[model samples]
Target: MTQPSEGPAATGVPTCYRHPDRETWIRCQRCDKPICPDCMRDAAVGFQCPDCVREASKGSRQNRALYGGERSADPRLTSYVLIGINALVWLAIAATGGTKSRLADLLALRANGLCSPGDGYLYDIERRVCESTGSTFLPAVDDGAWWQLVTSVFTHVEIWHVAMNMFALFIFGPALEGIIGRARFLAVYLVSGLASSVLVLFLSSQYGSTVGASGALFGLLGALLVAARKARLNSQWLMQNLAIGVVITVVGWRMISWQGHLGGFLGGVVAAALIAYAPKEHRPLVQWGGLALVTLVLLGLTALRVSTLA
Candidate 1:
């Protein structure tokens, strides 16, 4: 029997390798079985069987079942509350301090805001740069405060600044948390937030400040993008909504760092993708593939930045 192309071929007698009589219509790349499109899964750039997808989808539930700890916030409960706190912090800051720059300012940034020029010379202002050391790095032209990396995500400059961001996080956090578990979720959250800051830091080490949790939140969204695919859920709706958000953010807004958003998101998605979602007989090279790519990006960014300064 012939099979339809697993990917996209006009007309072919797709044959099922498993059942020779059955047309290998849709090929599952993982198991190499010919399944209908319904049973086909797009994963890591190839098609996988339904069983593979189901197994991948089970990681989150399995982890949750095995270990349930901490009464800290239900993750769901804290989702909205966390968002509220971020917004409130931003509002309080703005109300009292007036408009500030991005959240990175406290961590170790010294920029005025959102890649704002005139903050200071890149290396010239060590104090302005966000540092990995210390509690929150205060944005100064001389040296960056470090604690701010963690704290930056929580503070905002205005009321609406973090409000919408928190809303997005509140909505997406639970689904992501369910997939990765609290520990993994928080890890992604913090790590991605810092990753975003690192991206911003690479961009301009001057007096620019960053605020809001959108970068970290975007990381969750990024993870969900892959999770949705792995779980065999319809991603069209999500893809479109997120696309709109990207347009609004990248194309239509100022004071927004698409780099941070993209970097953090890539970090989170890659982090989630690192371990395996689908059942595999061996550790996937694709796991290392993402790491290599991110490392290259980070290294390239760091180099470009240094060269520019020099």
Candidate 2:
């Protein structure tokens, strides 16, 4: 018995939209376009051509999973906003001549110091040039500079410091935002930053102020580790980079604040744990509760430190 030939020319049937040389009886469910086996994609209802499938995907809603969530918001929106804020702050500082600028004095994080312009630290008031040690001589609790705990996260004394910290944030922020969503990620970043400042207030004896987003960026890394673990995702590379960062931080402890890094890392871990391990049924409430608890702890620490100063 002779088998019937399936060639397009032999059958004289409709050719595929993508490949005129191939004939197919199957058509896309949406567009009704003839498509070859290679162009066919399995859809919920029926087979679809590559073009129809792509178009459908663009219109379809994404589903939530066990690891992350529905991701209804733009994943990178938070990261871009954060980067923009940091960049704007850095540019403003640069325009004002950095440490000597009045803006810097107002924005920079001083744990327990209170120095202003013309207090002998502002050697060049007109040019906004001040001594690097200007922050060391200021009064702390006596002057009511408690807001430094929060403001410090946005302040950076020099170009290099801001650049380095922002670079780290740029690298890690988007990935984290994708994993935990905007609100949770923002909460982790801010709380960790505050935690870092609080640690500085307690641990450092010098009156010098510390500023930068290093603590917050480190907190993101810590959160990444925890979330990846909860999702059973491979985090070996993150671990390696974290170890390297720790070593670099230790070697440069003179220039960097170890206390800030430690506090931020711990805070990120705790915050992420609360978010990642939350029961699916009451995740939002549990996450909010965790955030509240963390905030209370940080506030308690800050109050305790201020009292000591008093």
Candidate 3:
């Protein structure tokens, strides 16, 4: 049998390279392959095929945030998640019991054991002394409730307390996430909270309990200040916020854990500095190493406090 003639119309009308059944006169500007509308991607000069678009993307450097983190598609997502967690914990505490909730008792950070004197009041005392007096002893961080260090960050009892913290997180969380990206933002938050707990462990009453996200929020404030300074951006708004925080901490010193706030702020400053000033040649290594070092230092402080309390 004679073979078909090889010419312009040798294969009949051209079809899409991806979908051979569909006939198309359009072709990719880059690869010159026949492409249908479905397979066509907008290019600088003309339409390009999906394969060419993907291949071009592979060779291009990824866009990163100001602090050398992957740009988040939705910077607000992490904040939303954190808010939801806090809300859920608060609801759980409320359902169990408001300020006197057992859940709150379990979650709040206390450096040492507490004893109930049968009058709905807690007093700091040794477990043996409490037991000898037929009083109820509540375990604390020194008593092996170590999880409180982190849990207290998410636990809150008073309506105003949780509302204020969540509001702060809502205001500042997304902006920080957008600047540093999700992972680094979360790192700053948790590390700041932990530092706050560490300070409470040492500076606050061993018998007194502490809980709330203020430490982490204070941390975000500090991080924002450092980040703005490093990026050479205007930071008047940040300074105002910091001023407000300082006023609140000072005014509420009797009722609030000022030590926690101080610890968190310092932690955030150090964390953001590490992230923003990391060497570009080895940015990830240096940034992560610095954060890890800070965490270890906080943990070491916590251990030392625990030893002293023990």
- Name the best candidate (by TM-score): 3
**Distance from true position, residue 8, model 3, in Å?**
11
TM-scores of the candidates in the order shown? 0.57, 0.72, 0.85
| Reference-based lDDT, residue 105, model 3 | 86
Lowest-sum lDDT 10-residue window in model 3: 1-10
Q: Which model is ahead, 1 or 3, in terms of TM-score?
A: 3
Report the C-alpha lDDT of model 2 over 235-279, residue by residue, as the tens digit.
998999799889989999998899999989988999999989998
As for lDDT, the candidate ahead, 1 or 3, is: 3
Where model 2 places Cα greater than 4 Å from the true spot, the runs are: 1-61, 65-73, 115-142
CA lDDT for candidate 2: 0.77
Candidate 3 Cα RMSD (Å): 5.4
Write down the lDDT of every candidate, Cα atoms only: 0.60, 0.77, 0.90
RMSD of candidate 1 to the truth, in angstroms, is 16.4
Clashing pairs in 2: 112-140, 113-138, 114-138, 114-139
